[model samples]
Target: MNNGTPHNTTGTMSANVSYYNENFVANSKFAIVKYSDRFFLQACMAFEGVSQYIDFWIPANIPGDGSIIELSLAANGGNLASYSRFPDGVALRARSGRLLMKYDWQTKRMEGNFSFEIQNGSTIVQISDGTFDLTGIVDGVSNSSIYGVGTFTAYSDQLGSFEAQEVSIELKDRSHVGLPNYWQIIGRMEKPEFPHPQRSHIALQVVEHVETKIHTLGNNPDAWASYFQEPDVGIIPAVNGTLEFTTLPNTGHTEGRLDADFRTAENVLIHVSGIFDIKQAKR
Candidate 1:
């Protein structure tokens, strides 16, 4: 993404915060070429960050080997550097209209609507509420701009469709302040394939296997505790029996959908893919 748009990067703090909020319009295009029976996809993402906007273009032409992509920041080799939450650098093997998005540190009350496409020529449009936390390690201990994850739920009528869109990282009211506002995940879906009627009986099993405690000291050192345990005895495990799940019949892969929601210690709510695996137990 290239933009004649200008950026503003002016800050003074102990930890350097790379600013990417400069307003600029980046135009990107994609072209898929078919040379043989296989199809190769090429995509480019351009956006303004810090001093200047950079371009990330990737081309994948090898059959069965998968595609490759990269992100380039600061075209003129400026002093500023941009960072992505995604540890894998640029998203690889992404289909058209597929994106891995996250909010910047400076953004607050992040809310937006976006669309995601699936392999079956279908799309999922989602609107979500952003999540946040006040644990800014780089901005010193007194910064108000919190960074964390958020929960999301959207409705769609399309069957057998699963996709994630409209993501953000933002702060919320004080009601969510310091309440162990940890992660909670729940999922429900339909079952598409059932070879054996009785054999196909399935249910989701949720485990609260982990927990972390945070104690903030006033302009002092931080303390915490961590542990792993099973689901609470009184509470029934969060599970949706007979939800639609993906299947691979050729290699003996079968199961139902497994939806998950998790809140990190940093107040980030991550929606992990809940794919179930069901089969006979070993003798």
Candidate 2:
């Protein structure tokens, strides 16, 4: 079945493919194959119950040649993330070509030379004109040597293809609640019973105080209550203020100093101030 020869079809493309590539057969050695909008091959190979081997194959609709493969779980309905363990085993022997896979958050692209070992033999990888064709025995048999369209390396060592799971949360009527804001009255300067040269007493004035909290309201009412009840739930608060303080001298004259602290509900603190306001009050 080598050499552009359309081999016999065990199953049509529209039908579920029981084989791995053109040669890699789906044996009971690993796991079973499942199909949806995409095909998933899952298998777990155990060794001494300590070490494990696994393989997950996902077919790409990308036209083979030198085209970017866009993979996404139909369930999740987004671009597929780049996978590591699911290494690009398909080797294109030809030069002057680039193998591009979608970029995951960690890496920019998935590119590699595809190599295969068949029946206890050395790893053989063929590259012709920038096209990699992986044709090797999977389990001591060439019958299962199908060119892997793609694979996914799960975060766990276990191998398997996961369709993107669609998940969504909504807020019923909390559009008005919004984020949380906070303010704390800090230390205040005062004249001790023992008078000093600083003059009269210093009175604390709470010009303004604000508190805010941010959070995502769950779709269900119960879920929202549970979420808000948690010690830490919501977005960062956005609130500010202008604090003005005045000090009076027993001589019927007034002077003062001003200090302001800007803070978020998350307890993040900052000092923002200008100057104190000194004005005489008309009796």
Candidate 3:
């Protein structure tokens, strides 16, 4: 989405950390256009003085034959967002980057990893080990399912994606005796306190799946629910169609897909499948 304005596209991007607390999740809309005599992959998220984005207009192009294209911090790129109104913030105004990207025409998907820097004033934010994926791509969608910053998609017909407008990602405990599940990703539309905004309002949680730890949470996928606070829509208690988790086995990460065919109040249903890549945030 451009400036919180929905665009039909997909872009999931995030950084490790920003010195000034940047909070702009790169939405799913990476377009390769010819600007002047070169081709640049224009994928960025900047708005209202909050920016945590990846905009690279390089000499490289995405291969349609399922090959890898490298993009990295080998180059350049901003912001002001405190620990309050935003969950994340940018510390630089101009910067460069390096990355490895790929696009599979057969699958209509794009995947890549990167490391870059954004220098604002005398401060510089060094973001490392960043990655993203784009699916259900079109001319580009802004309001579609943007899990974190990437335009997300439903793995199944029953599942769907959403934008929390305001969300919070907390590394709570899934207390399981000794193996207390370390990741209980709590993403809500509720604006958090000073130090509790979702990934500092910068990194939108990825749409990958975080395997469900039954011992920690529960096995009842139908009862698994999620809802919007303001819109007054929530998951229907007994209306879940499919609920499953594909865990990362021994890692502090997991992937999940759930489709609740019902809601708490209205006939609203909540469907979403994605990854909670909170392992890095906890570090």
Q: What is the alpha-carbon lDDT for the whole of candidate 2?
A: 0.21
Q: Which one wins by TM-score: 2 or 3?
A: 3
- The local lDDT score (0 to 100) that residue 268 gets in candidate 3 is 31
Which candidate would rank higher by TM-score, 1 or 3? 3
Query: Which 10 consecutive residues of model 1 have the lowest summed lDDT?
Result: 226-235
Question: All candidates' lDDT scores?
Answer: 0.21, 0.21, 0.37
Clashes of 3: 65
Per-residue lDDT of 30-136 in model 1, one digit per residue for the tens? 22222222221222223222111121221122222222222221212111111111111111111222222222324311111112111111222111121111111
Off by over 4 Å in 1: 1-180, 193-283
lDDT of 1 at 193: 46
lDDT of 1 at 113: 19
How many angstroms is residue 283 displaced in model 1 relative to the true structure, after the best TM-score fit? 19
Ranking by TM-score: 3, 2, 1
Q: After aligning candidate 3 to the native by TM-score, how far in Å is the CA of 244 from where it should be?
A: 58
List, residue by residue over 14-126, the lDDT tens digit for candidate 2. 11111222222221122223222222222211122111122223332334344456332221222111111101111111111223332122221222222212110122222
In order of appearance, the predictions have TM-scores of 0.15, 0.17, 0.34
